[model samples]
Target: MNEIILKFSKESPQVKDTPIEISVIDVQPDYLYKFNAGIDGIWTTIQDFSEENFCIWKPKIDGKYTLMIQGKKKDGKKSFDAAAKADYIIGAVEEDIIQSVNIDRRELLQGEKLSVMVETTVKPVMYKYWISGKDGWELIRDYNSENEFLFTANEPGKHEILVECKTIESKNNFDDFRTISFIVSEIEKVQITDFKCLSTELLTDKELIFQVDARHEDSRMVLYKFVKIDNKGKALCIQDYSSKRMISFTEREPGSYKLLCMAKDMYSTEDFDDRAIIVYDIKPYKPIVIKSFTTDFTSPQTTGTKILLKAMVEGGRNLLYRYMIEGKHGEDSGFIRNNSFLWETKYPGEYKLSLYVKDESYSGDYEECTSLEYLVEEKLFKPVKIRDVALSKDKNYVKNKPINITVSADGGNELRYSFIVYKDKEEVEKINFGIANWVNFTPEQSGEYELEIRVRDKYSHKDYDSHTFIFFNVRDYIPGIIDYILIPSKEYYMVEDDIEIEVITQNAKETLLKYCISINGHPVESTEYSKVKKFKFTPKVSGKYNLEIYSKNIQCKEGYDEKKETKIYIHEALPVTNTKIKSSLVKAKRNEEVTFVVNSEGGKDVCYEFYLMEEENWKLVQRYSKKNYYTFIPFISGTYRLLALSRSFYKKVSYEDYDIFKLEVN
Candidate 1:
């Protein structure tokens, strides 16, 4: 039993000149299909030379088409004329079709990317995209099957994106077009957050504390500055810009004061990222007096190390505080709201740490500060002692190859090493005690060698603090190339034929091979050293070419092995195009023999195979061989469908060309 099914690349309602693919599915045994199409019940044969199951075609006229598939079976004495048909319509081309275009965002900042997609009634054949920015129009993408694109907003201004769509078989540049516009702005600026006065009283004698908070994108660092403006509008610097957002100060001549606080990003390019102002009047208040200032820290600490100072005050309100370090590395902590500080210095000596406190507003720079003595002893590091020197010297070392030596030591803050190489009894190379602890030494000549490593800290003054040594040997190598051969052993080389190279080697460890080419005794090209065992060379043009190959050891100073092939001729190639299948009889009786022959053109050493698609799968009637003919005899009554496939001996693919033929046995 046999049933036919048809599949098309495009559905009905297609227009003229639209390419379409048709596939026939007949899995039943002894079945093959013949395709034909027409408008009415009567169908005309379609002249398409394709596979027995598939074909491609384009409709030239606009109308409805009825496609018919005639099926047959390869057997004896049974009628196998099973048939199936399908309908396809060719509609008129419609103009002014609508397309859908959408964008991810309408507004964005410069340096951001936007996504857009276009949609139509059917899949378009091609799409073109263009972007219009401050620099006029630019083609973003050319004709392609993609419906989406990512547009980058590099300029700060109005921008537009245009997309053109083309459906199947359309000749115009675009069948439908759509556009979208967007606006891109610059980077966001900073703004001043809320500012608060932490002090209880605004008086001249008392300490006043002010804290400002601001942030632009949480992870960005913000620095703050505080300035005081008098009644005369003249600005005086209270505290310069710093990462600390709190400040404490005492105003002696306090009247009407306007405080300006500004916040900015640490790396912001603007004058001020954000700013805020505060207006207030100062009145006379009680003087600030330090009652009992307590501090905690282990003294006699090492220099060049960070130490924390934990401080607590019992003064007025402790609303404002300041710290000053007096020594070789002096620094002022400026008036801040925090009481503790971290100090570090490279110099070691006597030092004094002082802290001043105030309650609220200030009158003058009087006293409310306490001092603490610190003994910063010099930090000493131990001399570098050689611990372990690891090396892989058991393996044979060849001349001219690099030897790497590395050493590790203990008990040094900053250690330096000196590598000394000795050949025989004489010194060859040496690096002074520097930060480098690893070195590579290449032996220029075969010899007995010794490597010595010495390590010392920067503070050590002796000739060496710790030393170690190792011994190794280097040996010379011999180079030789035995022979080489070319594939396809042809007298005349073709212009487009691939030739393989096979090389045999002797004492081949670390041997480098080079391929040199020349034309008529003039050198044209030479390749670098490689271990090429399976190299393919394809000739592009016909010429009298000379090919030379050489092998040598990279570690050896001079000797090499060479081979050459001279004055080889290359000719143009002939291409295999197709094969034609012919049959002796179109109809035959039961048990009658049928003969089929295949003919080929421009083929080189061609071979043929005969196959029959009579059932669920094709059965091989004849395997690939030099004989170009096939003989067939049928038993069960049906039709015989034979396919001939031809391939060249040198071709890598399965078959170059094929043809189908039919024979009916009644």
Candidate 2:
């Protein structure tokens, strides 16, 4: 006999008035269980355990009791097999009450299930529920040992529920109670959303079926009515109100007709919840569907390679297929009934293959069409791009200077050109290809610049037919004076001479030459600077004149390109034009008292200086003075020469004119 043992977890002594569940871990399926309690060393059967459920016990008084379970032989009689017992202490009255009561659904529509669950602070408690619904307050459920209840919401309105729970051994009405409110909405009327017919599906002779779509929240039985409306404004009932959602007809009428459907619940209050109508034009039926027209191709093969391209036709009768495949090096397009085509790919590039299909009896262009991408290639040849062409010019470059580029292309077709400029290895400007064969560019900064010129035919498919580039550099711009010229080259300039001073400048392109001229320590003619490269002036009086030239570029403000100064003397014309030495004799003896006076024309306060030749040397007979005449007496002279010089009273250029005379003494 196996020893029987009872496991009691009600220790630390459970409440006296509370019920405890007694369950046995080891029990035979063909046995009846008997639960007993010990009273003064004697075991008394307190409750009988059913095979379907465990036995529950509620202690009447506080005491130490032994709880035991006996395994029996049959369901009717007690044939003891093994017994197990566990001692338990029953304290005073236990206040096992409900901890919380909650309704699983807070709001629901009619015909939906709502559950109320009750939880207690301890197990083995009784729950009861009272509901105030559309029928007013009533005891919906009596007290039960179960902790929850589920029921369908039949009535519509705000339903208030009251739940109460108490210990199984408690004699009181309730230990705890809770109140909760929820609303049960009325069942929504059924709405007929749409009436549909599968026109593409095949049916038997004179057979038609349309599906009806309806919406509702109620679980009640629904009925749908179908009506047939002809183009003549006549209506006929095709289907009466029934539980069927689809209507079937055997009418072979071949005119335009409207099919209408009305849907509603069996117990709805309205005449018809919702009605839907669909226009149907009945005609002789023939089905043709080009579900998909697809093309299949294998990888590319070498030259003279034959590729079998197939067109996949899914659904259609007597369908004709057409194919078109195109690439740069090869292309094929044809229309045929055969599903496969043999293609020889001569190009090595990406290709797109299109397949089109149409039913023989169909009037439309095509029923279905699809495209496929495949390539037939060999070892890839070099890319024949538009390159190795160049645009060049033999010239120096400067900043902010514009230059023109002329493309020299020998293509047979119309040409186009594009220009791109890069400064310091970075692109700064670009012009796209167009019909024009020339491009103009301006350098913006001083650096290494590259101009790339690309050309192509106007209708060429490639990016360009030829392209070339040239590298060049730009030097920094600094204004400079080239040179200056004094017009009319001459030894000396008279006081009234019109002097032309022309200055030249070597500055940046598009930069003008501004001149600032000054003479005699003052700004002359043009005090302000201007674009005056050539300046002319007439000096009224004779004086030493200072000529200064300042040339500058327009981009500068404070300084000039170069500063140049030159000194020029402008004198008055010779005032004394003719002068002569007048003597009493051409030859005179020593101390002969020869009177040699200077007589001159065109003179004013003239001062004369006299000189005589003696011993192969000229000697001054008298210094310059206000005296115009002089006395000459030769002392020892074989042949004597006397000279007279005259000038203006001011004698600006020493002496303007002079005369010489030959005198002899014998």
lDDT (10s digit) by residue, model 2, range 217-332: 55578888888898898999977788778766655555688888888877665667889888877643444444333322234333444455655455555767777776776554
Computed on alpha carbons, the lDDT of every model, listed in order, comes to: 0.71, 0.67
Cα error of candidate 2 at position 453, Å:
3.5
TM-score of each: 0.23, 0.30
Name the regions of candidate 2 deviating beyond 4 angstroms. Answer: 1-403, 409-418, 431-436, 442-449, 454-492, 496-526, 531-546, 551-568, 572-579, 587-591, 599-607, 614-618, 634-638, 645-658
lDDT per residue as tens, model 1, 1-666: 546788899987577788888787654555565678876334577643223776666877654477766666655345445666676756554564536789999998655779998877776558888776533445689888888888767667887787767776887656666668989876566677688888778877767889887757665577788999988899998777777788878877658888999887665656678899988788655455653333222355456656655445544434577778899778888778876777775688888888877755554563478888876768764335566676645556768888777788876677778988899868998888888778888888887887778776677665565666666677786445545554567765777788766666755666677777766545678887776754567878756777777777676566454544445666543545667788788788888888888998865788888898664357988888889999877786776788998877666667888998877778
Candidate 2, lDDT over the whole model: 0.67
Model 1, residue 517: C-alpha shift (Å): 13
Clashing pairs in 2: 300-376, 389-467, 389-468, 390-468
